[model samples]
Target: MSLTVDIQFKRSSKIYHQGPISLINQSVEVTKSGKIPPGQTEIPFELPLSPRSSSKTLYETYHGLYVIVQYSLRCDIKRSLLAKDVSKLQEFIVEYRPSNGETDEKKAVKFEIRPETLQNVRDRARIPQFLVRGHLDSAVFPLSKPLTGELTVCECERGISSIELQLVRVETCGSAEGHTKEASEIQNIQIGEGDVCRGMAIPVYMVFPRLFTCATTIAPNFKIEFELSIVIIFDNDHLVVETFPIKLTRN
Candidate 1:
């Protein structure tokens, strides 16, 4: 028995905007002509993702609350002169494919805003600033699947008092030990304080928490994003908000 192989790339955070970050360490030997008096043996290798700072093509395999990139294969065995040396490991995933008229693959995230433009630019903010809009039939979801949406309140002259829907989890973490956290899940589609309704088609259902949901990722420091907010509560105080960017996949 004589073997040796090591191929690795694991980066959750190390910081690199573009140049100088390579850690796909490589090694191979694999029991050349020795370890098998039995059966089954096949070893082939190829690992090269070199000097890549451009030509962007691979990054889609994520588990994020920060970042997570993984791939590993380690095996070392030797049974010779005194015998005693063995190690084995396997944990792998490196997938990002799109090359036939490549559009770079990642679609389904629609956007449209103007719920007071997330309110805060008030200078006596008026002029049709409350007609809401929202739609998310699919923004990539399958964490036990239940997120239907459609909220189209065509006009609001500061009448509706309650209509809030928020399911947010935006986490960002840096490697020098920086930290940020956000978690939310609130639901109440519509409920006026007295009696209010301008134009309505509101129907939004929400169910999120497969295992505390996570599937958006980006690394350098770390990032996790998922948002869906539409709060148009105005019985006169006027608080209109809008946001959308969601992906809670485990598919």
Candidate 2:
């Protein structure tokens, strides 16, 4: 038997900030086992951001700018039919909150989701069938000025599963001229389960090229906008997977 999973985003939302700020919002929708069926499930989550009083504001002087926002999806499964054993699955949680007073416009932020954790749940649950899939919508926004810098993403743990990072895609746009470009670049890197039980970090780096030719338009005034997409596949009789979007800016 094969299990199927489906995910979706209701709306491509945008957030605005100025002078020390914290924002939290949900950016995706996830559904499993078809539209509406037995044992089917749907989960919604929020992305949180908090400002740091110690950090300097991006627009202390005032300017218009924007940063790309990314969303992540996570799932955990546990073995054992016993309520106590299965209940341990609840303890396996994935939390994503902003570190400090960092705005999407000031510096690019990288977000990671654990794959091993989810696989562990499946093993504990003793489920014979497994399947996972993720989907994201297409949308973009303009942010208030004084954009932050670029972001680098590194995965620390393989978590709970025996899956590999199969695909990664990146997209970028010129801030001053709005010249947009996108690339599917996951093949450039090698992804594997470093140490099944201990977990490992997958590193991803992105660089934005400068487009302006004249000095007048180059007073540290060029901006690079980016979008990152990723996909993962698990080792099982059926397919198990996860995915999300990330946005960043280069100063």
Candidate 3:
């Protein structure tokens, strides 16, 4: 039997990120005869989790639209010429160890969305008068905790069709020569539908998805960042967006 651990990095067609690096590859002898008997057999083995060299470092496993980090194990069984070789591959997750660093004070953010605060408006007179008030409990969030906040529609001349919270992942991959950055939506959750009541507080809550997200990472060659967008769609299908950049940590 053999064990192998490989880390693969790939780029999209439009010159993104590409490369597959092997961290560990080793052959292990499980049986004296190098053969297995009939029906059912159980074998137990243990291997140290370490990189092949001192220079190589393991990164957290992440699945993104254009960039991905993955760790996998493979076991191969050799057979006679009459039979074909058999192999099995299993994927595993890797994460950074939580640090005991000092915690930062939680900072709450208050925001108001008005027509004047909107951007890229071709004609301000076309937009209905509206006011929105909200606050995020904290600008920095731990991966294990849910994002909590509240928003209220203070006043609006036009009816609202829906209000949604969007989580976006901004992935940047490149080297010293250049880099490519792309933003993709990880999830969209609706907080309000139809005409919502004025002066009523609508709670904001979102759980960071597993595998699709990790602690905000910054490396020389790549970066994994996150942001949030609050989308409000009016009855006429016109929409306005407010974006917020957030920091993530493992506490």
Candidate 4:
């Protein structure tokens, strides 16, 4: 019996740019000899983890649009030539310990989202008059806690169909020549719907998914970042978006 530990960091060839690559592929012998006599059996073993190369380091497990970092463990048992070998594989998550240098301060950010403040609008003539005021609890968020905020629609000429909060992940892969950056939505949650009451505060909340996000990472070869978008869709299908860049840390 043997145990194999594999960690792969790859860029999707179909959706993104590069081919699949393996960063770490190593295995350890669990036991020199073993026999299974009964129905259910449990064996205990331990394996130390480290990257194969001296300069390489293990990154946290992350799933992104352009890049992916993953870890898995596989167990294999070799039988006679007539009997096929048995194997099982399972995925695992890896996270870094909170750094002692991390600060505990939380800074709130306030903003006003109006038609004039929308940056991505192609046509100003199509946007209706609207004013939205809000403040995020903090610009920096702990990965274990939920992102919280509140927003109020002070005035709007047209009715609203839905108000949504979207979490986006930005992944940058670097090479000797240059770097390619890709941004994709991780999750979107609707906080308000169907023309909500004017001047009434609407609550904003979102949980960071475990497998999809990690402490905003900046490495030599690649970088990972996150951003938030506040989308307001009108009844007539006209939409306005407000984007905010956020920092994520491990507490």
Candidate 5:
């Protein structure tokens, strides 16, 4: 038995589509191009990657209603010619959001999480003892600006032990067939632990990179979503997580 591996940057149609179309913008294969025996895999291996002159490296991984700009690595295992072969495909992401540098734009963005908003996770039969709420100072921020907000935790059993904030970009792509979805992290920060007491208020601040990150957008093939996630961890091992979606456009 033997194995071969390859990585590729490509624009491809969703799976299951008849006559699927794909453009292999770039591909890099391991230099050791022989069906090396599995037993010989003890040696280290390195592969070179290069893009075509006309090909463009991804600015942002996009999932469109009909297509996807996908980055993937594939591994193929081969055995006797009469035997069947096996292959595996893994998808990855590229992100381009930069950090808050210097910008004069300042705008306020507020998010309200009422009890009703927490219904999906909260048991309707039992009342929740705590509520997690927060709001960013600005709805639209440059990468250089801190995503500043105030967090309030209404707790009945002491206060929350930890608070976490993250900026994420979610993309979905597919058609009449099926769909593939991916979420990439733009920025994440743990606000660290605080006093475990009721009525705890914490001010949040963090910045995301601006390199390849772009403003929020939607298309038939895919949509880019930005969100702030608040996680409340308790000393008792219970968890409360809330997500507040936001627009990442400039003022």
Candidate 6:
């Protein structure tokens, strides 16, 4: 069976001060899969940084900017079984580019902000609308094996002005029983403010498992269903959340 995976980044807020708001750079890739080329799919481009006039703050902001990124992935399984196990995919990379006549290959600056520093600007640095899309293929897997994949956002830099990482949340759902209640939480490793320097990319990775364990005894001809969603929050109030769907059929 054929499966499709869709990914998107949407920014919901912005606070630009003492600088021009141009483009928001983003990239996506399938770093790992059970039977397909891991790093073969990529979509790199920029989104216009057009914020509503009402979304701006009037403070003497040291770093008056915020953004949010949302991402999602979906897949299909050709075979169904009473019980199955899934493994986490590995890391993927994402980077940002400035439109001020800079090279796309420019290195990113690293900065880490303390929790206290982030708390000060948490309300001001909100992400408004950042989104991107892509897909993955799972046609080569055998009935005994399942399809798995991973996606990640690389470190993003905004010149001398620093961007902060605030919060990250992920959710999943599907036709399979209790699939919606499966929550895998990652421990947040706090990086100090200004630690991620300008022109550099911060990497966040998400691994996807291909198999779903059956909730009860079932027939061999029945189908198994699944869905997944990921949400990321930045200091600037920007948020990115994407959802993916998958189905396992009887062979």
TM-score of each: 0.34, 0.23, 0.89, 0.89, 0.52, 0.23
Task: Report the lDDT tens digits of candidate 4 across residue range 1-251.
Answer: 23333333345433434544455666777766557777987778876667667427777888776777777788888877798998998877889888789576898889999977778678888789999999999988999899999999999999999999999998888755477777889999999989999999999899999989999989777889999999999998989989999989897
Q: Give the residue spans of candidate 3 off by over 4 A.
A: 1-17, 23-27, 52-56, 122-125
Ranking by TM-score: 4, 3, 5, 1, 2, 6
How much is the lDDT of residue 171 in candidate 2?
30
Flag clash pairs in model 1: 3-31
Give Cα-based local distance difference scores for all models.
0.54, 0.29, 0.83, 0.82, 0.55, 0.28
lDDT of 2: 0.29
In angstroms, how far off is 19's CA in candidate 5? Answer: 13
Candidate 2, residue 210: lDDT: 23
Q: What lDDT score is found at residue 120 in candidate 6?
A: 30
lDDT of 1 by residue, 1-251 (tens): 12212212223345432222334445666446475666886776555644234423344333333344444567777678887977787755554332345232345444455643554656445434555555767777755557776666666555666777777767665434455454445334442343345566566777765433545665554466788776665666556566677776555
lDDT of 3 by residue, 1-251 (tens): 55555444455546544665566667677656566779999988766667767526666888987667777667777788899988898888888877788875799989999999998887676678999999999888998899989999999999999999999999887855567787999999999999999999999999999899998888656789999899999998888889999988887
Candidate 2 stretches with Cα past 4 Å from truth are: 1-188, 199-226, 237-241, 248-250
Worst 10 residues of 3 by lDDT: 7-16
Summed backbone clashes in each candidate are 1, 35, 1, 0, 22, 63
Evaluate model 1: give its lDDT: 0.54
C-alpha lDDT (0 to 100) for residue 89 of candidate 2? 13
Q: Where is model 1 more than 4 Å wrong at Cα? A: 1-29, 33-60, 63-68, 72-118, 122-141, 144-147, 156-169, 180-225, 229-241, 244-251
Q: How close is candidate 4 to the true structure, as a TM-score?
A: 0.89
Which segments of model 5 are wrong by more than 4 Å?
1-107, 111-116, 122-128, 175-179, 184-186, 194-200
Residue lDDT tens for model 2, 1-251: 11111111111122322221222222333333333347955555543333234322121111112222222233433334563421111111222332355433423333334444353345533333222222222222122122122212233222323343332333332333333333343332224342233222334332222221101111122233233343333343333343334432221
Quote the lDDT for 95 in model 5.
52
Candidate 5 residues 1-251, lDDT tens each?
12222222222432344333232433344444456656646644443334444433333444433334455566665557797987777765655556456654655655555446664664443334656555678666654456787877654444456667877766555455555566666666888576444456678887766443555656444456677777666556555567767666543
